[model samples]
Target: MAPKVLIVLTSQATISSVDKPTGWYLPEFAHPYYKLAGKCDITIASPAGGEAPLDQGSVKMFEGDEECQKFLKEESSLWKKTEKLESFKGKASQFDAIFYVGGHGPMFDLANSAISHDIIREFYESSKVVSAVCHGPAALVNAKLSDGSYLIAGQQVTGFSNTEEDQVGMSKAMPFMLETDLKKNSGSDSLFVAAAEPWGSKVVVSGKNGKLITGQNPASAGPVGEALLQALGA
Candidate 1:
């Protein structure tokens, strides 16, 4: 049987402070979803269980990306109805991995969600894969292990960088800088790696069997999916 993978997306539709619409980024979800489509039993889900919103900004940004456009035209329905994150509580064993999709929206909602933390803990404690990209790492911000230790503590990881946030002029608008929070949770700055420059592809894989994985920015989305596949032996 193929490995079962659950892809979590943010439900928050807008960045209220900036008066900008935000949710999961198109490339982040499209790249990964297509990569794992035929190889795994994949389910797209969100905190609210209904339609998970899309970041309109990503649509304009990735308008020329062939794969991203393909997904938008054909597979857009995949996110139209998502399973509720709560529905999977205590069911981590049923899946081989959990992937969090990224966008600025996750920084606001998933970052502070107790249920998101609990669900991630369920997957992590089960020795299953816990992965994310860009702002998706927001889901892992304060998530702790059964021992009460922050999950990312002592774990090598990467996500949307502080510089990237500033480059986009969203640093002040974001509730917290993803890179900074990840470093804090990691208990050190060196553990939170980054690419040579902003908007570059950087994926970090840690933990036994490379179960804990993360990507630095939108450019790293597809590679993160590939890493997840390799980790699952798929």
Candidate 2:
């Protein structure tokens, strides 16, 4: 059988009083989906059983791209009806890798989700390729390894940075900044653009062991997806 890749999404429905639109960032999910769909069986899961929230900004950012628009309009059913993390009956060992898709919603809910944290820890402990992008890394803040250490300790990683957050004007509203939390956790070498705006930027992947890939923003989705595929040897 082909290697299986589990793609986890946040089911968070709201962010700072704004209702989360349904679905995920088109490029973030679609780029990876197109790349991996042919090479591996992909399973989509979320914190809640039903529809996951999509970022409206993402939709607008990629609206001019026809392929992405098609993904949002016609090819988003699997993600729309993703299984709840708690209801996932498969063992973590069944999958060869895991990728966490991010949007603003993740910052609100993914970190607090026990099941999501467990899934991440399971993949990490098993030495599977573990990846996350943007605010998706928020989930890692609470993930602990078997030795009771944060999984990100000493890991050179990047996510939606505090600088990017300020660029997007959401830094003040977010419960906590990902960069600050990552530094507080175990990510000592977290990096991001200090002056660039946050809509889209290059993805960052570091550490050869256990594959920890993180994208700075939506622009990094395709590269991040390719990186994950390369890591999986798919």
Candidate 3:
């Protein structure tokens, strides 16, 4: 049977702290979704359960990309109606992996969601892949295991970096810097690595058997998906 994957999206429609509208980054979701489309069984889910908002800025930014445009036109329904995160509680055995898609939106909702934490913990403890990209690692910052250790502690990981956030002029607006936070929770500074340049693709896979995966930015989405597939042996 094909591996079952759960793709988690943020329901936050706006970065209320900055009063800027934001949601899941289109390319982050689209690229990974397309990469795993035929290779795995996928499910779309979110904190709010319906109409997970889209970051309009991303749509315009990637408008020149053919595949991204096609995703917008053909996959509207996927993001329009998402299953609530709560519904997946205790159902970790049903999935081979859990992926978090990023946007500034996740910094507000998924990052602090108790439900999301529980779901992630369950998946990790179940020996299933736990993955996220860009600001998506916000979801991992506080995720802990039963023994009370941060899941990414001492485990190599990467996410939206301080440089990228500054370049985007959202450093001050973000609740906390992803790179710094990830490294802090990782119990060391060296565990988190960023790309050599802003917006460059960087994916990190680390675990006893490479089950914890993360991508550095939107540019790393497809690679992150590929990494997840490889980790799953799919």
Candidate 4:
């Protein structure tokens, strides 16, 4: 059987109490979707399991892109029929890898979901590939391993940086600074591998012995997916 990948999206549609309409970044999800679609068996899931919200800013940002247009035209069941993460607990060992697609909304949901932490811990502890991009890193930063160390501890990882957050005027809007959280949560034995430039297309592949792949922003989404495929030897 082909390797199976679980793509988890945020169920919340707004950015915490900010009252701003937000959810998964379209390109962050779409770019990787197209890249991995036929290559592996993929399942899209969320905390609630249906109607994942779209961050309008991201939709507008990529509105003219061909892949985004195609994804919007169909709005397939893959996006509409996501399964609840709790349902995957029994099958966690069965998944070959997992991907967390991000947007501003994840700060409010996926990042805080106990279910999210459990799933990441499951995949990471199993040594199966674990990947995330953009704000998606929020989901993995707090995941505690069996040893109680952060999953990103000692791993080369990248996510939305402070500069990027400020550049987008979301520095204060977010409940917590993502980059700082990653480093702060980095174990005493490990720290984050910082990216040189804010918007640079960078994907940090840590865990050569363990599989943890993370990308900095939307620009890094495609590369992240490619890296996951490489990690899987696809």
Report lDDT (CA) for all predictions: 0.92, 0.75, 0.93, 0.84
Worst 10 residues of 1 by lDDT: 172-181
TM-score for candidate 3, residues paired by index: 0.98
Q: How do the predictions measure up, each by TM-score?
A: 0.98, 0.89, 0.98, 0.94
**Which tens-of-lDDT digit does each residue in 120-221 have in candidate 4?**
888887888999999999998888888888777767777888888999988878889998898887653235554677777888887756488889999898
lDDT per residue as tens, model 1, 73-183: 998778998989998988999999999999998998899899989999989889999999999999997899889999999999999988888899999898888888899
Model 1 bad stretches (over 4 Å) = none
Clashes of 1: 0
Ranking by lDDT: 3, 1, 4, 2
The candidate, 1 or 4, that scores higher on lDDT is 1
Candidate 4 lDDT score at position 186: 68
lDDT value for model 1: 0.92
Error of 2 at 199 (Å): 5.9
Stretches of candidate 4 off by over 4 Å are 188-190, 208-210
Q: What tens digits encode model 2's per-residue C-alpha lDDT throughout 1-234? A: 777998888776656354434335667787777778778998888877667777777888888987678787777687778887876533778888888887777787887777777778888777788887777788777788778888777776667877778887777678789888887776454433221555556666665563787777767777788888888888
What are the root-mean-square deviations of the candidates from the true structure over C-alphas? 0.7, 2.6, 0.7, 1.8
Count clashes in each candidate, considering only residues at least 3 apart in sequence or on different chains. 0, 1, 0, 0
